[model samples]
Target: MGCKSCGSGTNEDGTPKGCGSKGACNTSSCNQRSTYDWLSDLGIDDPYAASIVEVSFKNGASKDFYYAPSELEVFTGDNVAVETKNGYNVGRITLSGELVRLQMKKKKVREEKVTESIIRRANTRDMERLAEVRDMERSTLVKARAIARSNHSKMKITDVEFQGDGKKATIYYTCDERVDFRELVRQFSHQFRIKIEMRQIGPRQESARLGGIGSCGRELCCSTWLSDFSSVNTAAARYQNIAINQAKLSGQCGRLKCCLNYELDTYMEALEVFPKKADKLRTEAGLAILIKTDIFKGIMYYTYKENRGLLYPIPVAKVHEILAMNKAGDKPIDLQSNQLVVEEKDDVFGYEDVTGAIELPAEKRRKKRRKKKSGTNAKGRSSGSGRKPASGDSRAKTGEAKTSNTGDKPAAGGETKEGSRSSKRRRGRSNNRNKKRGENASAGPKASSGGGDKPANKPSTPKPTGEGGKGGSSSSGRKKRTPRRKKRGGDAPKGD
Candidate 1:
């Protein structure tokens, strides 16, 4: 959205950085290459604010001035219906107030000649109908081309625009030779059931009507704000010291880009300071022919027959002195001896590469993974977990790990370690609760279940952690361990 045309993109916010049309940033503010209304922000109430206003139709493909009725309020970017030759057409206000007078004067359009009056601001119904009418253009274009091709017409129908009321349509086209579209128009009227306008235009105008992205990666200026297409020639490139690349110079219209003439005047003014017809110079190193010129630098590069690949850059003043000397029957020592030293800068893409060594995070991660796998693959694996004490760690490592391993162990009390901790009391009264639960379990029916036949003080042995443990060995004064469920989908995939 940071494009220049998107300056007046929003209704009240400050100008956006870009014209949204450059990409698919179809914001509401980007009303088909709208110009930002900077004057409106001045907040000065002009007496002639509601004069004739310039309106943009079809997203600026065409524009016309409409007289703004003093009774009605109007502003730039307002959608208003204006009078047409046949019916009312909808267009957005682009220029109004005092600016309209300046534009009219520039275009030499008489204010009295602007007879069309603004009918009214388009309402909801009118906006909806306008959308429906525009949606028909895509399919209409396809059908239009088919009808023309069936009639064996050589012209290509570039675009189709329907009237606001949907009672008439205009078909724009381009052709090299004259075409008889009388029969084509008759078929169009019968099929479309409306008035048909067959408008013939040149290639440039055709491209302007149906806009496209230019080679410069922007919307065609003709479709945006470029109302006129000036003739461009190869001379503009030569004057600016540009290579005459036809493919690069050509535009979407298959002609030289109109932008070629944008800075042509500036190049012309700069070239006024350069000496013309100074292509060759007689020197001791042989005849030096002009190779290239740095126009802004006022330096000209030349190559001699003796040094074919090498080039010597000479200033304009020095070239003139040598030319005057040659005219007086004198030759300089050599073009190189009098050449200006052009400093070569090693710059690339606005950035420079500094050579140094640094470690890549990805490589470091890979090395860490290799170290982790090597460390984990080595056994006892259980000791690294720091779970059991120093001596019991070796015994725990012999066990094949379960899918779900418990971090908590059973306390001396009948209650398991997980069930015994009662929130903060465990932090404040840990020993008291364990001792109390043990005393209670030892005194009651839990006591009968605790030691039933064997005595409670006997030390217990570490049973095998897997499948062979006994289920009926509750006589060991310890809770019977329940077998863990096998993992779903059989064994899990191997890597951690």
Candidate 2:
């Protein structure tokens, strides 16, 4: 018997060692139905002449009740030979003493019904024979499956177990429907030259016999200690608020996970207080649809039809009250108005709201400002505040006047002087308007430039000259006019 659970290798005498007890075999930790014989531990003498013992074969894959003869001294974890259908089979004693009676009652096996008796404590010869049979199981299983497939049997052969004496073999298989394996069994018997017994089991049983790790990262419960499997369905998942995903819900057995039923009763009891048909709550805002439920917290989440992503967590008692009101044909003002409000204290050092303070970098801000300025200019032009100059005739006339007046001045300072005088004129005009409107004089120039309406085009006024003559007066006026012409020409086509 190989203890796959503990990964304990076989001893030199061919018997499995330790039973995965981890030095706790005395505490009855090896088999699934472990029984700590406290009476034997207390040194209490046996009261019965013969006691029923539970012997497990194939590493607890199969177990049977055997009558222990008073003549043979046996204990739990001891290797013993037991009577089978044909010859004797060797197995480990899993249960002994008074606990054996309780285990038999649990399994519904009566004392008189268990006619099989332990033949003897396994000796060296028996251990060697058992090891030989165990070694032949793998090859026999492969050959049996091939024979079944060749015979066109609609069955999956999962495992094969040989008798200790090598005179018999048990073939375990799984099939969705009833399968007649009479011919298949006959082929196995002839090919292997042993008595063949075919056993049909469900997917869960097959997985238990062929044990492996489950999705929970542990050995399969059925293979370890779960001798009985309860019916598991989607209802268990629904009760526990688990998503209905086939791959997640189904276990290695291709059925709903058995663990689903573990907390199902608690979930059922918790949900009983919840209002029935309360999935949709009537409200003045709209029909509030139920999203999900938190059974432990006693909270149900609901969202209105018009508003999404805003879940209102209502207590179970309040939900029932609302449902009762709805039954009486009264609608609540809003779901939130009746919801349970859990006050959360603000953390002084927690993350502050930076939404309003957030600003773009300087380069990005400059770009945005330029974009706004261009858009405003476009709007101003469209609204008739500024019109495109059709031709350069107005510019030519002013340019000629400036050339004649500034002909004597040095070219270096003439442009700068002209620009300064134009700016002064603009400021003067804005200041005069601000005085008339009674507005702040300091803001006038900025207001004129920043406003959607551009400044009105006005003729430049000549500066007073020291030499009071007709030619001097005209030339001074011409100098002022030249700068305006240059400014107008700046907007002309590049070719000009």
Candidate 3:
């Protein structure tokens, strides 16, 4: 028989012997052992060997593969040979029986098609060779891009993954359209001695591969559960009333975000009860267009012609009533005329001419003129009283004559009385008095009336003007006086 991993010789009972190549031979059966045949062949019933539960197909049933009881412990990331319907195909152990069953249920695979038997386990040499292939992937990418650039291809080199056997590497790239990467694959295989596969992806898949947090603060759905990308359009924006210019409404793809459609049905349902702005309504004076409406507020503004053709505001409820009346073929009542505010009329008798007719202007004039005329009359009355009285004039004239008559008489009488009394007293005192004591007389030696007397020496007085003891005016004796008017230098000679 042919070996599953490397196409080499097999043992009897259709079991694979050792594989042919380095990565190819690690999982081969070193000893040919069927299910439940390990302990007996080893010559000891050692209980340390774990019993094999099942063998699982890693890549599914296009290849023939199997694993032995001891190889059941092989996990994912461990390269293993899995038995398929035909030849053995090798894949990493991505899942076991229970998980594979679930995956089968998810993929709806038939129960008989699933392989649940192990062949053998991976050894050290297999792991080391896989690491060698991983180490080669980085350098292979640089050479691949250079090859693509030489061919003038617009394809991008995103990532490279080597198969477990080191026979093939898959290259992921993004391009605007289909790319002919046949030359790139040829160059890669020639340079690296391996098969090459190119995979194309979109911006969303590129974002998922790079891994990012979305605007909603979560891992991208494409990286999580979303394997399919649906087309998002701006129509979703119109349905949700989202402003088309808002950056949040656009996603990293520069298109309307997919989340806008998530709640569109709810908004559409809410919009059903709203009134459209297309309807027209009439008013008493003129027509008004329906501009906008607040649905929740149940209010709308209507414009109608008023003074000077300017539109005035009215409510929607009022417009609806008017529209209803118009539909009923009845003209709307002019509430503006009927509801005019009528002022109460005043009694003519009680109304004191506020308009200030005939006598009013005169009355105002009289009020202004009264102050002047009264002030003039008061000035005239006061001026009449302030005039000197004729009695006062007569008394002033008579008192002037009396003052002239009494002026000499009072002077002569006072002089006669003073002279007579002084002369009589002087005679009486001279007749009754004795000589004063010498000490008393001498105590005031400079007296005028006592016996001891001496005349005080006096300075000569200045002579008076034009009198018995005065002199004729001299240049130095005249008082200095200022002239009343300035003396003119010259005058026009008798008015020319």
- TM-score (all chains, Cα) for each model: 0.64, 0.63, 0.39
Most accurate candidate by lDDT: 2
**Which candidate order results from sorting by lDDT in descending order?**
2, 1, 3
Tens-place lDDT per residue, model 2, 1-496, is 4443244557665545643232113322255434444444444556773478888887788889898887887876778889888999988776777778878888788788988899998897998898888989999888887888888888999999989899988888999899877777777878999898888899999888887788889888888778788888898898898889999999898998899988888999998988778879888889999998999899999998777879999999989988988899998999878888888878667788897799766563333321211111111321111213234222221222232243433222122111233443444453444334443222222212221133433322233344553212233333211112223445642210
| Alpha-carbon local distance difference test for all models | 0.66, 0.67, 0.45
* Candidate 3 C-alpha error for residue 213, in Å: 3.2
For candidate 3, lDDT tens digit of each residue in 375-405?
Answer: 1111132111111323424121212212222
Cα lDDT of model 1 overall?
Answer: 0.66
Residue-wise lDDT of candidate 1 within 133-162, one digit each (tens)?
889999999999999898888998998988
lDDT of 3 at 31: 15
lDDT, candidate 1, at 17 = 37
Stretches off by above 4 angstroms in model 3 are 1-138, 246-249, 275-496
> Model 1: what TM-score?
0.64
lDDT value for candidate 2?
Answer: 0.67
